[model samples]
Target chain A: MNHLDEKDIRKLTEETVKQLGSSATPELVENVVKEAIDRIQYKAGSHVIDTSPLKKAALQQSGNRIIVTAFGKNRVGILAGLTGILARHKCNILDLTQKLLQEFFTIMILVDINESPVDFDTIKTDVTRVGEELDLKVVIQHEEIFNAMHRV
Target chain B: MPIAIEEILETIRMTEVEHFDIRTVTMGISLKDCCSDDLNKLKKNIYEKIMRVAAEHVMVAKKIESDYGISIANKRIAVTPISLIADAYHKEDFIEIAQTLDKAAHELGIDFLGGFSALVQKGATPGEQNMMHAVPDALASTQHICSSVNVATTKAGINMDAVKLMGEVIKQTAQLTGDKDAIGCAKLVVFANVPEDNPFIAGAFHGVSEPDVVINVGISGPGVILRTIREIPDTLDISTLSDHIRRMAFKITRAGEYLGKKVAEMQNVQFGIVDISLAPTPVPGDSVADILKAIGLEDVGAAGTTAALALLNDSVKRGGMMASSYVGGMSGAFIPVSEDEGMIRAAERGNISIEKLEAMTSVCSVGLDMIAIPGKTSAEIISGIIADECAIGISNNKTTAVRIIPVPGKDVGESVNYGGLLGMAPIMGCSQLSNNIFINRGGRFPAPVKGINN
Candidate 1:
């Protein structure tokens, strides 16, 4: 893969402006050049040779799910304890992400709660209690990721 | 590029250069639990509850205003109708409750306290009857207390008995406070199809469905609309002017919605409805009648003014409804005679007659608002006005009310200045033709044709 440097990008913008003449406003030219650079960088930065295998795995996990957004300090075994309680309640973890803001970390978890007969309130209480034990703040909100992405 | 950022900032600054912000931010508190047989405890409970609920309103409102650069015109409180709160009490308890509310409002630094009211649309409850009996003395004794009575609704019909009683009460309230320039009756309103969530004073009351605490914002921008209209060229057609007005209303409502949501969020309370009514002030250029006159009318009651007002009201609602999801209360232009300098001028010149104002109410918002009639007008004639306004509301399925004060020693073409935001108004005369037989029938006017379903 090849990437366009700043000089090349500038040249492309000038040429596009010349072809479009005075019809192209400055804001329009800026938007076009920025979009082109983003596309080139995304293609150059990709390391995966195949994306289909990842898509197949994502499709197989389609079920009732909930997303929990927690904000607090990071700690050891925080994910394990959170997932451990969900596992005890027969809940499945679908996806998770943790980002650090200074010394504090915020975690967002996507979990499947379809296999258990327990309602949302029960799962929320269990996860909240686990968060309290781990000294983290947690909120569990319902989300149907599969339906949201596919139906809409 | 586009319009210079400096020009946009200048336009924004121009909006504030002479802008007198809304005069008040009134909270409608419900006093349902203050009823007691012991008048002293009832007064204590009423005072404590109002003080507790409104203790931080002025502080929070001031902080929010300073932080956000938006001015809050007034900080006041309205409670559930005092009659409802005094259900188990006597007439003396009503006066005690009113005095307590007035004292609490004064202590809390509020300009006016509302909900000294009675709802007697179907019939006067025992407590409502007692409150009615005490209204003359209660209103005369209190300085900052406001009162209202709802004697009609679309579903329940009008109670002629209640209407007749309110007429006498209005006369008495006026005569007792006549020395105060008729200020007592000025703070009273007689309404039909009244809303529960209205944030304006003299009529605001905490509705049943409201949260324990909430902040309702009434957005007023008659000045902005008037400025926009003044800039339009006379060559343009009426539709073009309507379009311009609608677009301006949309922008104003958008600003209001943004500010309302932010205020509710800061107050940690539910976001109540945005009263998009263009409430005017006594300021020179901020009158609704001025907006009407700006659209080429010499005065509010001039020919073609009603048609112009109908367009303005319709376009305003259409624009405001699109701007906000929860648009409620009196969401149209308010033409309060004593509250608008232009209206006062028109009435003084004999340009806007009482009948023309009534006709204007058919198309504009609120009916016969803040009108001062002559003291000699009979109670039967007042009932006739109530019947006419309530009939408009019942037939059209909208809110309509009358807050007419029978100014003593003032007749047609004579003006009295109540000063400040209450403004000044010329006395409009009513028909001397007797309606006593009709008013004394004392039976309910059946719900309008539209209110019935076979």
Candidate 2:
């Protein structure tokens, strides 16, 4: 995972402190910094994967965005394994949030594949495969469906 | 975070758990241009035209399903009413045309093709009469062909002669397909004030004024609304509960319109309308009757059922109208007894009777849908039943229809099971009272007063 630089963390903490007023504490600042880092992961992989047959076909991209959600038992290296496949395909992480409740883990990932050469179906199949390998249930859908239902 | 987490989860849960889906993406193709004096030429023209226009329909619906993660339940086709084009042909020619339509639908992998129909609200032309005569044979001989006849309308009143003919036609259809529990009657609808752009069958048809080629979508979500009502606290007033129903309807209709427009764009056709009908299936959770029960009725036949249904039907339209620019078709809550598990249970327990269903139809969408009666019922009684339903529709100026099947050799204690979406129907007893004197004295019931006739 790519971490937020100190400059970005400092800016986030300043805003958090202003919103928190006198309630702001060192521990709250630390938690805010961690959340900011978990919310975005960018510019991680420079190398691209070799071209496969799946790369030649393009998914009928809907606004070039996709939502990936996963739920399962919490374990180490789950995020690393999931993000590694996205990185290899040159997909950008627009926003991400992951949480561990008791022994279960849940994640919601917003990814933009405008920069990736792989088709939508290929990337989705790859991500679902990686999810299986990590012992998690996963679903990927176009972002427009969410927009149509939730927004005007 | 562009969409709130709760909204996203709600959408997912609706699709995955509540059975929210686009009920159908129906392609309405006009066959008026296919009319010909030469019978063979007419048949060939119809088959080719439907095949050409709907070749990509199923393919496009499947693509949108996977891309958006919303499942579409059915892909169907509707054509212009055959009577207009079959005026130059006879009953045999109409039967052949029906067969041709069945073949084309089968080739294109469509489940149902509607519009083997004749509109004789006032009176039937010679050709229209021939086509109506062909209905029993057309429906029995073909697999996927559905037929409907408009025998009454608000402006034209009730054509009792046409109604009498339809009564005979339905009995013949039932006898012809009696091996399959009189399944032929399941595909035939007799209507008063039927909407032309209705995407639901066996009533869907490309209207005379519609574009040459259009796509209409039917959206279904009784399960979603049932869950929404269940989540609301009973302490809240009815008005507040209606607001919640409206909001959920808004979301469901928006999703339907999006998918419909996207499919039309991909197919390079005009998008017609989104029919926001709360159509239920045989599945337990996806039931309009359950929604009525959830609205505080002990059962679907309880005293307050019609009021509860009226509230649900109106709120759905209120929310759906705001969500889409074009809203047409019969956008009411369907209470088909066989298709809805809750309704089936209600009927089985003797909780809902045919008379109560008729009264409920005054407020709900379609009338007397998927009801099975004893084989011993007379055609004059069937006509009486139909005339009564038509009277309600013409008086209220809303669409009403009857898809009642009189199962051959079956009685009130017996049930007919056709399986699949045409769920099992318990034979409900109809009034044995005779209206033969009135039916035999038929010409026209005459149009009702338009206003100030309470």
Candidate 3:
């Protein structure tokens, strides 16, 4: 509940004016002080008491999941190739998205690797090989799998 | 009160603009327990322990990457130095360990497995000698195994005997893997004052003092910084530009700190450093040179580029330090030749040279990374580059390493494509003047005056 006093606000305004110099308008100084106070409040626990429906809704979506990353050149049947591979491996592609950079393509496929018979290495090698055949580069990895392995 | 839609949109935009995400969440696991006089058992123990420990890495990395929508460039393992684990084993035993590590990394789906290393900064132990002897063959035969040899330190000084031996080791490693374009050398690095818990490899290793399990994160966002600088108005003064860079760095570091702490908490391990180096990729949009250009340079490696890099590196450290308690590793700009498209382009366009790159390393982090030299460049010249870079690190009291590729059948101006993360680089010329006389002196360079603290 502690907020910046009028004197503290005035001091911050002066500091802003000094920093901004010729560009500092009264309105600009006021805005800067307001933003600073909001940031301070957020850091100082004012924003922690979330009673909103949106907050409750957001908290519900948190859970453990898997991610599959694909990177390589954009080519004909890139997505089809990936889909076929995933289907053949019996990997349930939960959510899929792709981005095109220049002529290259990066696809991210979320899947349940635990239920899938295909291991990550096989998937990676197969995908990379498929990408190679298609003249693209590909990489597949699972989320937090590395940390879980070595980070005792 | 409910947040407005506009406010929510603004928050999303800010998050996206900041590129707030974890770059790498590396786990360092010790393998000392796997060591034994029985070579087969030692190799088996090493492989089993590594595979058991690293089995979950890919899954966890993928999960984290998805939850955060950030690309975790790699999931890697750094083990106890093989010398420590192979103390009783012979040279072939060390090679077996390397092959074992390569196999485990391959099977576990990890990108690179590091700590195929020897720490002989003062002098080589019996085990260290064996590991060093096995490096060429080990590196040549492995696919994902990475190796490092720390032959010097600030306190220990440069071990010239080890350096001399490493020069020949480099030659042998290059010669052994000549058919693979000396890809083995790409997996090798030599260093001074190397950090033990570095999350990046082939450099990462678990320090002796570190806990059994710990999470270290390396955050890279040259693209974000480059994009921000590109938005800067041309009329802004240098100070203003610096301020803008500082602000962007603050946001980037804060993101790294947030994710690092979260991951450590989840993993129930101590949170290690957040490496603030702007690690670049071969991707065109992710070029570090583009960052220089965004900061007002016409091209990277051009005039004023070194000074600009110094400023950028310093400001990043300043902001990152303010944002996180644990900030370490090569916390500066990275100028990897093959890994950075802009640097590669600069080298191709003849805007950057080996000498200028060396000068730039006096300010940047990780000197001379993935630089391809001509096949004809002597082992002496390669050693000379390593010596020069190590001197810079030892003098300045920082971590600097060299990973130079002596590309076969390639000369200055010709490009060698390494594909993937290794990228591509145009071979840069080296000096003809041989430093063999000085190099063959084979004596430790005394520690700097500043290092003589009682």
Give the C-alpha lDDT of model 1: 0.76
Interface RMSD of each: 17.0, 7.0, 12.0
Query: Local error of candidate 1 at B30, Å?
Result: 2.6
lDDT (10s digit) by residue, model 3, range A56-122 = 2222333333454556666789888878877787766545667786986766665555556766666
lDDT of 3 at B20: 36
Give a tens-digit lDDT track for model 2, residues B1-454: 5556666677878988999999999999999899888999999999999999999999999989987888999999999999998887789989999999999999999999999988999999999999999999999999999999999988889999998888989899999999998999999999999999999989998888889999999999999999999998878889998999999999999999999999999999999999999999999899999999998988999999889999999999999998999898999999999999999999999999999999999998899999999998888888888898999999999999999999999999889998988999999999999888988887988888772355
Task: Considering chain A alone, report the TM-score of candidate 2 relative to the true chain A.
Answer: 0.60
TM-score of chain B of 2: 0.99
Alpha-carbon RMSD, candidate 2:
7.4
| Candidate 1, B1-454: lDDT as tens digits | 0122232332233246435244445566667677677788888988998899778888877754543334667776768888876787778878877888889989998888888888888898787899988888888998888888898988888888988888888888889998976788788888888888888877777776666666666777788788878999878898899888887677666555655565666666677777778888888788889989988888888999788788889878887887778887678888899999899888878888889988888887688888889888877888888888888887887788888898877787776788887888788877778889889999788887787866
Chain B TM-score by candidate, in order shown: 0.95, 0.99, 0.94
Which regions of candidate 1 are displaced past 4 Å?
A1-152, B1-11, B18-24
DockQ of each: 0.02, 0.26, 0.03
Look at candidate 2 and give me any clashing residue pairs. Answer: none
What TM-score quantifies how close candidate 1 is to the native fold? Answer: 0.74
Against the reference, the lDDT scores of all candidates come to: 0.76, 0.89, 0.74
Error of 3 at B116 (Å): 0.6
